[model samples]
Target: MRRRAADYRRPARRRLSCWIWGLLVIFSVAGFALFVLHHNQHQEDHVEQTALETNTKNERVVHKHLNFTEEILSVRSYARQLAEQMTLAKAYVIIAKEHNNFHLAWELSSKIRSCQSLLSKAAKKNEPVSLDDAGPIIRSLSSLIFKAQDAYYDIATTMITMKSHIQALEKLANVATVQSTVFGQLAAESVPKNLQCIYIKLTAIWLEKNSLRELADERRNSLQLVDNNLYHFCLFSDNLLAVSVVVNSTVSNADHPKQLVFHIVTNGVKYGAMQAWFLGNDFKGATLEVQNIEDFSWLNASYSPVLKQINDEDLQRSYFERTKDMSLEPKLRNPKYVSLLNHLRFYIPEIYPLLEKVVFLDDDVVVQKDLTPLFSLDLHGNVNGAVETCLESFHRFYKYLNFSNPIISTKFDPQACGWAFGLNVFDLIAWRKENVTALYHYWQEQNADGSLWKLGTLPPGFLAFYGLTEPLDRRWHVLGLGYDLNIDNHLIETAAVIHFNGNMKPWLKLGIGRLVCSTSNSHYPEKLSTTLPQIINGSMVIDAKGPRRSLKVRRKMSSLKYAIKGNQFKIRHDIVVSIQRKSKREM
Candidate 1:
């Protein structure tokens, strides 16, 4: 009885002990896993809350980070480094060449070429080329060329840093006695001249034509615009061809051209040409009134404070001087600074006293779609209907204004956004009520000392119409045609109006065959119609040397010259016709 009792007790005790141990192990493992899960969940929740709190603050950081000062400095530093590398490589090539070391010279030359390509890409394409990759710095000329008063200012800044390196390399090459022939060759070959020359020629032809009175007399009173329409479109341009393109495009595309009335305000020099062009060209039924700004004797340099400041040679020189760092492009510095016609739009309400509302268009723009909708837009009592530049991520007030000045920085928000001047729907009544003219004059006088903002009338316009501007749809006006060659084809097709806002005008010789056709998918008037009868097939490059050999010679002169690649089409008035004949089988 004793033995049986001991055996049962021992077995039961062992079983109980084993069961307890197993239960303890299970609890310990489960507790550790649960703790880990809780900790992870807490970390995720904390992270989410932190992100939510910091989102707007992070945006501010991004804004400050994208400032112009930092951007320009980065560009300067990167450009300097690249220039130095290029100079050094070129120097090495010269040394190798002097030594008759062909292999070494070739290797160094290849490296130099590669460096030049990267440098050119930075300057031309605005592409970020990595110097050492803290990040890639973009030294873009688009803003300078298209928007800024002094297009060469940024170029001048980069050039200041590049001069020492260029000099050092030249010294090395001089010592080797081989010369920096590559740079010299590149200097001659790199600049694309045909398009530029063509542009200059076309403008020169328009400006220098002698028979102004005869041209004016020919079309004196055939069909003058009444200026009594419910809706009017105003244009200010010096180019005759550009005006024709704009009016043609508008009338052709409009749902009712007869309802539209166009008021063209041009300089005295171009008025005759404009009148002659309009008189000869068929406008379907749209009425066009041509007004010579000079005819309004009251509107002189003294009359308009903006014109007074704009014409100041000393003030203009302060903004546009030929520095060692500035671009040597003759068109940028030498051309009349901010043409008088560009400033004429500021006097719209005064110029057209009777009109309640009018749509103002720059000559560089072409209307592809009907604009009757623009006339119907409410505008909510705002004076202006314009495309807001801030909608574009890259475009901001900082792009145009010098925010370093306290007057500008405090008065205007750097990130407040800006509007395009190319295409605008202005409420003349509202403008008069607000005395926008007086405000514009006030801003112009304030900026006389260059204290407020630098060149261009748009800055003053921005000040005048700040609160009164109503942002229109981006589709109404598509810009950057002159700056961006690879502008989206889809954007061009969908846009109601396309604006060529830079130096590369579509009427230029280079532009005649390519840019206009590429952007519009329509034949340019120069190539198709009787725009330039003297210049055959848009081939002759109007060079300083006077009369080139042939189109073949011009084509051979530079491979970079955009060749007429696509099939030519005939554009009669607004209609674009395919010149290619149908196959006999189809007929």
Candidate 2:
């Protein structure tokens, strides 16, 4: 009985222990599952927080880029406004100086300098400037300008009533006129060093080559010169590059290049260089004849009043040398007044007597279209066909001729329309019948002392061809490319010829930037490339690779070889190839 009781106790104890172990296992599994769920929730929260932070950073970078672009745009706008204001300030300063208001000029200039300083600082800091920063100063300047203008107007009105003041004003006017004359004289006479270098280089090239001496003597197309059936164009110039541009532009635009005849008359000094340039290059089968003006023995001082004027020592001193008296008329000091080339237009009848009609082109002009149609135009018995320059009657006969001279006042009306000389079609038949050369000579003699008119060929030309000029279409020749910056681009493109008839010649450093592009498009002498880098502003070192020779240059070289060798087949092939290449480029 005791043994059986002990076995029952042991079994009960074992069952109790087993139940406790099962509860422990269940608790452990539940705790582990809860821990895993808690960890997964924490990790998901961390991942969401990281994505939000990255998105914010990306947005900040994009916003920064946009802000930077806006700042750049704002800076450009500010700069443009500043430039305009600066220009206005300069004009105001000029006016103040002219009126002897030095205090106002100094004040305005100081303000402008301060504005410039602010701009520089802003630019250095890469900060955008606001136009409003200059607003208060500009408003103050405007008010000052208005006040000064009012004061001047009052003074002008007061002076009109006072006799003594009027006399003083006249004296002041005379002084101002004299000062202006001196300024103009200096401006016109001063030749830039670059132009001098070009002239020297071209002349030196001619002098160096003995083979180029007989270049202009070639008579290959002598009969075509006087052939009335062909188009005859005459140019009188001393500038080799200018002549080249005129010839090149003409030949490039011509419909029938073979029928073109160009007769260039230059001074004795430039004859060799002019001849060498023309002979070295081919003008697309156009006949080019260069004549030395000194060769015409009949164009002596005894017969030509201009030659006499050129020979006068007093005239030479007054024109070529500086003097203490600034009162000399600016026109009197112009070297062009003494140039035989300037006066040669009057002797065109004598120069090409055989040609019944001819077109005269100035060296400064660029032909834009085929000039063959000009020869076919009828003059209706007029000696000259020209574009009238009297849109507002500003360029009337009175503008050129002195109305005080009875010979001019009685013969020509002040309101009579004037014509330009740069481009003209001359009727040699009528010119000879009217003895126009004698008329020109008579007018030239009358103006020898320069009392009748200013010292330019235009005045004499106006007198000689007073009633004999036929008005041409203004589109045929557009003027003011040199001086008028506001000329329409469409007008320039559509015009047959554009004239650079002012001080800002296309070749000069001071030439208008846009106008220079027109001339730069034409082929320049290869030597010009080497010399141009020397004169170009800023850098002294030449380009190591040198300028790339243009396709036009290669074509020109090929044409030159053909001209020398007289290879008809090769020239024809080259022309075809050039035409095809040009067509492909256009396409």
Candidate 3:
């Protein structure tokens, strides 16, 4: 009986073991299935994300291509219109000559000459000509056609000849359209005649013996130049009036004018004029120092990529001269890429070795508010404090760098934000610790062939200061006053500084009318008007006692005086006040 019972218990135990083994097998299979499912889902998610990014990139390329195509089409249309008007004008000129109408011929010839002048400007500037520009010739040609018909001047034959001319021009227009596009892309910036005239007159004044002798006087506040407790500003520029405006505006808006110090560094060619302007003018109680960049014996080809490029004759020709290849990039031809002054901002640490921090201002900027508060802003261990330009996404690293290069692709992010250079608060202590200049040198050496980047100092700035820049509020610096037209007026009014960072400088005739007023409203040195008068017909007459009087001479003098005192035709409020006081006294 005992043996039978033990056999029964053993069989029961075997059944229990079988049940446990089956349960373990079922749970293991379930866990493996769940793991496989999750792995597949993660891979799908990654592929989807990659596809989305690729599509976005393709869309941006397509949009850019569309914009380029539209520009070409508009240019072609304008060319055809201009060609038609020119042909019509030529036919009218022939009819007038044949009829021996001297006055009519002269009038038509004058209109033709004016059209030719406009064509010359359009060709040289690489700017598009509008139908409205040919309005005068169109009207003259229409009136002449009526007169020719009345006089039986073989109008039909003239029309036939004009048709052939128009047809020939149409063919040439196609070639011109392509050339115009290329020229437009590679247009080089040059000093305007008015600015060149100003510079010449200022230099003449600078050379005069005993003229602006006050500039040679030593300042008692010279010790404040490198004072870390004070608000220090550095300006790197060649334009005298621009520097004056910058200094004047800064001084005018400062909370403690005596606490401000400006260190200006310009090229050797403009040092005399720059020094003379600042010396002749007063900026409340602010300290000003002007130094020549050429005096810096250390800043040579061995230290600067731009200096090396300038020393290369092949690079100079490629940058300044027109090339026939349409494939050449536009930025490669920009002359500013070779200018040492444009790249001087990178060497601020070396320029002022003693300053712990600085607020660097571009010559094209105007200060509207006190900037002393900028010094107190915490940088959180960053080297640069700048206004980020990446709100539009066009200013990201991908836009400025050659991402196709393996070095750039592997080391940096394409979508990282970019910052502006025109207005920056640099922490010199942090900058030195990070050796930012050495980093800039390394990248610049890597891009010695101009492959890693295309143009401007901002690209290298982006690389050297990556992850080391703290973004400031946009209100600190408002940009696009030079090129963008649709910026909000409220934003401009509230901004601490307004920057004209593009081709249209406020001092140039090409500057936007409204934006120029905003710049002109800022204070400039009073001596600027007296020292450098307005230029008329490419000549400047510097008469300290004002011009002599005839009825016509007085009229010209009145306009010129208005221009000089009013700061380029925009009358200042202070000038208006003086006029009001004079009227009261006369009454």
Candidate 4:
């Protein structure tokens, strides 16, 4: 009975205790969480609000950034309108006076007065008002108005009055804009509106341009990125397949078993050379040739680092044998480039003389691979000349010149001209002969006249003269100028000859070396740095001895013929010839 009585209050007390403790813990946790969340939210809201306010202020300032341009344009328009109104008012007054309607004349005079007042007010208000400080314009306008008024009032009932009015206007104003001259300047055309239309057009054009750029950016950032990421995930890298250089070659002499080929390129201005070098590694049997002493000088001076190989007698023999029967006597006998012609012309009379085909290279490219297959590919005699650019449609050139086939019977008209690039395989023997010598002379004259045909212009002329219509594959020789790796997707995919066409050569002294660079890096001494392309950076060097020799050769008959001008080396063959002749005569 006693235990039962005690249990009744104990159970109730236990239940109450459990309930209170549970409630207390719940409330404590909830309060802590609420305090933290409230503080964090408040901080975040304040930061967000401050950011938004700052962004809004910046946007407002940026929006008003164009105010200067807008004001200038506005002032011009307003001033022009006022001028037109003043002119119309004067015309109306003149008509009224001619009609002898005093009422109409008086009415129009009032309008004229009103317009003048409006102009004066506008000019004045624009001065100190809101946008611009046109104080000078206001003063000029006031003075011009006075002068114009004298002219305007001088129009009396007779012709004499009109003449006097015109004279008065002439004496008062120089540009007919004496009124409100301080308002906006159109006199010196120094005003933004007059001189900077290009800037306005630029803004408008770039808006459209930027639209395209924006679209491109979006695609690049979104779709292109996704595609690239997906592609990278799927595959490793091996995008490049291969590269090659093709050199067209001729059969060696009947007695010689080897065939000879040449690589033509641009050097010191190796803008073309560097690209050709790196990319041309794919070509096989392609070798660079500097040829005679003068060419070697340019190769040494301009591209000093170019390593000279020991003479390959066997290679020379093969080249000689291949060119033996080739018909190029005319080019040799009457060369347009006298120095180059003379050096090769001495043996024009020799029958079965070796006339190897060598590529004249400008040091401005890089080779990626060996390039033998391309040069050696048998075109099945499709070439009109040694090298043919059948990809060019003669119509594109002729149509622009308005040279219809019907007009000029001559098929060789420049208007009808085809490709004129430098990568060519011509019959040197035939060129040496007088038959084709006149063509080189003509080209020389054309160049002297200032219209220097680019690398692509010569082959067409040569073939046209020879009446060669050769249709070949288009990938043999490719243009190498301005190959932007970012924009042109196809640049890395193919391999052919890339011509570096620009004012600056990649290997030249001032060149950035990205477009093209030199191949003679290890061959040239540091002191010989100012060779070829660097010639422009240094003073002229006319050694007229041996081209910057590492070791001086004794005064042999050919010793004094290094073509150095003053501080730079001479690469032109003509310079070498003069030295050689002088040295030989002295000996």
What is the TM-score (0 to 1) of candidate 4? 0.30
Q: What's the true lDDT of residue 542 in model 3?
A: 27
List candidate 3 segments past 4 Å from native: 1-188, 210-214, 325-332, 517-587
> Candidate 1 residues 43-162, lDDT tens each?
655534432332233223323223333433452444444454455445444544545767766755665565566666655644443433211211122111122212223554445445
Question: How well is each residue in 234-341 modelled by candidate 4, as lDDT tens digits?
Answer: 100000110111121111111121223332222222222223222223222222221123334432312221111112343234333434443322122121222222
lDDT of 3 by residue, 375-399 (tens): 9999999999999999998989999
Better of 1 and 3 by lDDT: 3
Which parts of model 1 have CA positions greater than 4 angstroms off? Answer: 1-229, 315-336, 510-514, 518-587
Model 1 lDDT-worst window of ten:
575-584
TM-score ranking from best candidate downward = 2, 3, 1, 4
Candidate 4: C-alpha RMSD after superposition: 31.9
Compared with the true structure, the alpha-carbon lDDT of candidate 4 equals 0.34
Task: List per-candidate RMSD values in Å.
Answer: 20.4, 23.1, 28.5, 31.9
The estimated TM-scores of all candidates read 0.56, 0.63, 0.62, 0.30
Off by over 4 Å in 4: 1-352, 355-369, 382-408, 413-417, 427-460, 463-466, 469-472, 480-489, 509-587
**What are the lDDT figures for the candidates, one per model?**
0.60, 0.70, 0.70, 0.34
Say which prediction, candidate 1 or candidate 4, comes out ahead on TM-score: 1
Q: What does the lDDT come to for candidate 1?
A: 0.60
- What 10-residue stretch in candidate 2 is worst by lDDT? 563-572
Candidate 2 lands at a TM-score of 0.63
